[model samples]
Target: MTIYEPTQEALRGELLQRLAKLSAPSSAKGSVPHGVDSGVNVFGYCVNARERFARSRLPHPAVVVVLSGTKEVWRGDVAQRFPRGVPFAIPAGLEIDLVNIPDPQSGRYESICITVDAPLRQSLRASLNGLPDGPSIPGSFGIALSADLVEAYGHAASALAAPEAATAEAVARHRIVEILLLLSGTHVGRMFVAVDRAEQLEAIVYADPSYAWRVEEVAGMLGMGASTLRRHLKQAGTSFRQVCLSARMATAGSLLSAPGYSVTQAAQAAGYASRSHFARQVRAAHGVAPGRLRSVA
Candidate 1:
């Protein structure tokens, strides 16, 4: 089946109307969550209302479409804007600060985010192996959406709205696969299929933060020279030491929030020999003490 490209203005209008109709009262003062909980890989998101600026992380690689309003994302020293009717891809494990602006006339901010986790990436890689060889695709933290991508997103949104559980799941999966196929047809799509070295390294460190991970050892595990690995990470706007620290801090935060997990346990798991050090890192990352994380988590 082919995807249909609708006019950008028309698409934006439709999304705004749908978001206004589905708007619900949220306990959090300036937030409204509108999305389908399909219990599958592909999920939808529509924020009817939100703070002017918010800090958040995707936790996984995702393609986010802005239906209405605008989203400004700042990663490291770079910032990009995804305006209405545009979509962008984000790499995994990056902490981002976001600014969401509503339309001046309508006062609504609506969007949809499709997350592609490890399992989905593996599936895409396997599927691409069967296709004929394509041109090399360079990796980037994000990519602008094409007309094909916009059409595919519209189809996925409609499919996810289906009432039947089985039908919705099947349709959602199909649309995702279709999008991947379309991407694979492009040079950039080839890059998306290949596992990003930075993402892989981050995952490894996150899995076992307690291990003393020397830069040389981590590079050896990836089968690359230490200097080469460092250069690769530098090109990605991060360093090995930063990745390890971020992973450890993220793990510590999760542990502190989990039930029955003590601060000591979190500290140890995050490779912190002292509770004070763990607390300091937690405060730096979250602007709150470790005890506060437990209360909120």
Candidate 2:
């Protein structure tokens, strides 16, 4: 099917209808179940009702397209709102709070988020290897939707709907690459071309938080000198110790929220030998005890 650029109102109406059709019926109030899985690590999101989830950290960089209603993303002390027809790019390895507010009239919020993985980044870098660099944009940007972007998203939705088709994956991959290329023209896109070494190190540590990670050991694993790794991390605005702590805390929070995991298990999974220390850290970072997370989860 051909993707057409519709008027903003028409686009919103169509996206909302798609969301309503995809949403599952459940008794749980304001719960966000999984939406579309594009089979290439990219997923789509649809919300039927307004839901306010607490602060959480996103481990990967994502492009969030707000189709209908609005969303509030809080990072540190700053809060930004993304309304319909806008796309927001979230940086990797940042702690954030998200609030998904549906349209008051329709009582629904619809959006799509495509996660950028290492393979996609490599693909993007290879594609832009010899291109003349454009004017450098900032590492961060505001959310705004354009006519081309809306049409691109509409096409993506269609491709996702029929994953069994031989061309579905190609279409999805192409669209993802297209989006990244458009982003690469901006300053923020430059950041995605090369994966941040510090973020890579953080992911390594996060995957196995129970392992005792040392800076020199991690540097060795990265095939770099300790001092060089430290320098690179400093440039990334963090240190080895900080990354370890952040990863552990984030893992602990996730574990606590999962069923069949006790506070002790969460603490252990986070590499905290001392339960009391784990509790203190969790309370400090999340403003609640580890036990509280289990109840909410």
Candidate 3:
């Protein structure tokens, strides 16, 4: 089927209109995040002003379609810039530094996030032929947002937005499946594979970054001995301390992203007692001072 590809600006305008209709009105400075509770399989997140965050961990394997402005993601030494109308796939438990730059005219940064959770991933594996069982290529990467995929995303959004609760779930699932089926053919499909040991540990720490976590305690939670956990981490080329610090910093970044969250509050949430210490740590890790993390001007 031939799908008409609209101009990127037109596509963004259409998506923004649909999103505004679906989402509640927001304050002047913050973000509006719509999810399953809003009866949609597709979620929309918009930031009114430019925002920068360090070590934001993605909890699930997902694809983010940038509808407007730009999203800059930093994963280790590699930096990827996703402009409007592009789709990028992210693996579960991956930590990334992000800069959300709003459009100069519209002054908003918006994107759609579709999570391919465990059940959906497994379902895709079972339904597809010749699915690989090996480990995924590390990190997130952008993929071509084909015209057909864009049309499929529209269908998925419509299905989830339908009024009939009974049929909405089934229809939404079907639409999502169609989108994923198309996505599976792309190079980014490799990211759909199993999560690694380091990812598992990172997720646990992210769940409660404020906790006083010890190697033995976390290892026990993962049902492995401390030594075994250390050995696995060694193979993964990371240590428990590194993972914990990363997760904590990610948690802090998330806290800092939202409006009305002071640096002190973010520090406390990330398990840091002193705000100065937290600021220093953030600068050391991300090279952006806490005070300069979110620059409105």
Candidate 4:
């Protein structure tokens, strides 16, 4: 590929600022970030706090940090609440729900977040390929972020507000490097998702749902004796039982919404041995029958 005159890092920084420009947080003084292009596209943006700030889902792998307010982040099954000095992750390919519970004494609150595009995964791996991994992934590596990372990201976020000619690109590139080291050390994205155990177990339960899966088959995927895996997940707030059921239910919902999937078909696609069991799970998760979701469109 032909290279641009500005180094990739320089370009990455500029793109990050541009991304921040495109995203409007609930508040006016959201975190403004600056950085170099680094040949990777980073969505480094900011948003301010409101009395009650809430945002819908956007597709990307995002890391958020609170600057001057407190906020709560909810994934499908996990909830994380943090104050102005910490960071968190919104993993790739998952729906996100955000809410900012204000500190009444302070009267106002704010937060800033940066989204690492799923495609940008390539750039990150390339930059720090040889470095030893950081002991932690400041923002959960798309799973969840830690409090100190929140503080550091809060500090890094200010770099976005810097003038374009200033530390904008350099600053963004710096944070990206920090994130890269964190991810490289993770052998398998073990810490990346806070979803249920069965859902987590699906990688081993037969990614191809068409295949049969016995309980032992699922347990083996976790690389532990069945009893041990069951015990560990119970302590971790998830279970393969719930995981399998929830995963099937989640999958059924998607297929049911598609243009050609009849309820019977969606049931089979989600690994239901029979339609009755599939419909039962659907009813439990959505309250309404699967048919209710038939496209209005």
Candidate 5:
């Protein structure tokens, strides 16, 4: 439950023997081995020990992100020392290994683990700057996840606590995607949707086509540095101008396609000060004149 100081030492004592018993990379004897899911689904909520225990190496990619605990966990040589509120991402390739190093001698440990495939792992790697044009934080063979890691751990814990079978499988996967966005600070919803500036990037451009917006709006909203957000967007193959134009046109097109909404009305609806300007944007976005697009609608 909590991997405090004395607890970690105690866990190591029994770890090897218990692992020996499981044969296929086992965990501490009493801890549940919640079955694997081929990475297509997430296998989660694995508690290895209460006071102390042993575990075996995991067969596939997995990360035992510490939600609340003190311990050392790793795959192969890259050992990570972490505490409560840290979600360390262990790239899912190395040999499974863990050691108990609880805090203030508490001797107890607990964590929320997520299992995803290598491609997702690459995405995480490219997106780690946690913002557009931010520094590129490379994924490691055994590196601990970013300081931003703590955020996603909360979501994983909640989901693992109450998995729903009735929901479509896509719902579950999307939830993981949500967690990844939060962890990376890419999706503005992770923080305050209304208050975070990053949400502005997520803002409906069509809502106000002529409205002047700056990159700072999105960067500020998400509490991320502007440079980082820019770099990330570039790496992800998008520029700020591109996203903004798309947002505006999408909003205007929706308005244009509606009954009783003329081209002028649609332009104003999309926040354009002049219908002519709105028309030009529509042409740029769809590669056709506004009237032409309107004719089709």
Candidate 6:
């Protein structure tokens, strides 16, 4: 079920038609429609022009379908590109620079991002019958979105648009579970096990990057002693400071990607009082000045 370039083009056409109908006119660019709740949530974004989000962090694993345009993700030295109709999966707690390129003729770039929550990941893993977890890939990787996967997305989208919010949640989860089950047979399926501790810490810090996080406090939340937490992080070759900074910068990058976000606001959102200091950190992390990374329109 490998999706070739031609097949992807045709698939994208059908996906766009389904998503366009499901898409409600959003006042905010890249805003999550239907809200993010529980462990599973679905949202669609349509961009009329080109956009880039630097150091954006995905706290949960995501499966994205590029509807009309293309998505380019930079993970360290590698660049993984997903053109229209190509679906990709990103591991939890991944920080990457993302670009959205609109179609030349249609002048639009749209995608549907579905995040798999912890509970769903566990359920999906258990269904594998004790299969060992797959190696964690460095960044987002493209996967063959077979006919069944596409059908799952269509069902999820429809469920998201259900009149009752509760109904939408229930039906969408069922559909998303089906999608994951189908994905388990792919190369990326093995990476779908429970997220690691470092990833968990990063997600927590990302949820509120502004908070001054101490190792002791965070360890308490994770239900472990400070020493054990430190040992775990030490084995992973990272420290609390590094994790906090990564989460903060990722948060700052995301803020800069939003419309009307100022460098100072982004800095403050990430808990930096000094603009100069924040600029230095942003440059160190993303290799770009905060002002340069600001989103236009």
Clashes of each: 0, 0, 0, 29, 38, 0
Q: Which one is best on lDDT?
A: 6
For candidate 5, write residues 1-297 as lDDT tens digits.
Answer: 975443333433333222222222224322443333333345323344444233343333444444335656553344556655333443221223566443444444444455555455445545553323211121122223332233333333344444455543444455566565554442111111211222235332322344565676545533467788787668767877776666567666665655667787767655677777777888877788877777787
Q: Compared to the true structure, candidate 2 yields what TM-score?
A: 0.54
Model 1 has an lDDT value of 0.62
Pitting candidate 2 against candidate 3, the one with the higher TM-score is 3
Query: How high is the CA lDDT of each candidate model?
Result: 0.62, 0.64, 0.66, 0.50, 0.46, 0.71
Error of 3 at 69 (Å): 1.4
Q: Give, for candidate 6, the lowest lDDT window spanning 10 residues.
A: 131-140
Q: Can you tell me which runs of candidate 6 are displaced by over 4 Å?
A: 1-12, 26-28, 35-37, 132-140, 164-166, 198-230, 233-297
Ranking by TM-score: 6, 3, 2, 1, 4, 5
- When 3 and 6 are scored with TM-score, the better candidate is 6
Candidate number that wins on TM-score, 4 or 5: 4
The list of candidate 3 runs beyond 4 A from truth reads 1-41, 130-140, 164-166, 195-297
Candidate 1 C-alpha lDDT tens digits along 115-172? 6666667777788774323222112333444556656655766666654566765776
Query: How close is every model to the real structure, measured as TM-score?
Result: 0.51, 0.54, 0.56, 0.41, 0.35, 0.59
> Candidate 4 on 113-179: residue-level lDDT in tens?
5555433554554554422322121222222333333334434555555546466667766765565
Give candidate 5 misplaced runs (Cα > 4 Å).
1-59, 73-79, 95-97, 102-106, 118-156, 168-170, 181-297
Stronger candidate by TM-score (2 vs 5): 2
In the predicted model 2, the residue pairs found to clash are: none
- Model 3 weakest 10-residue run by lDDT: 131-140
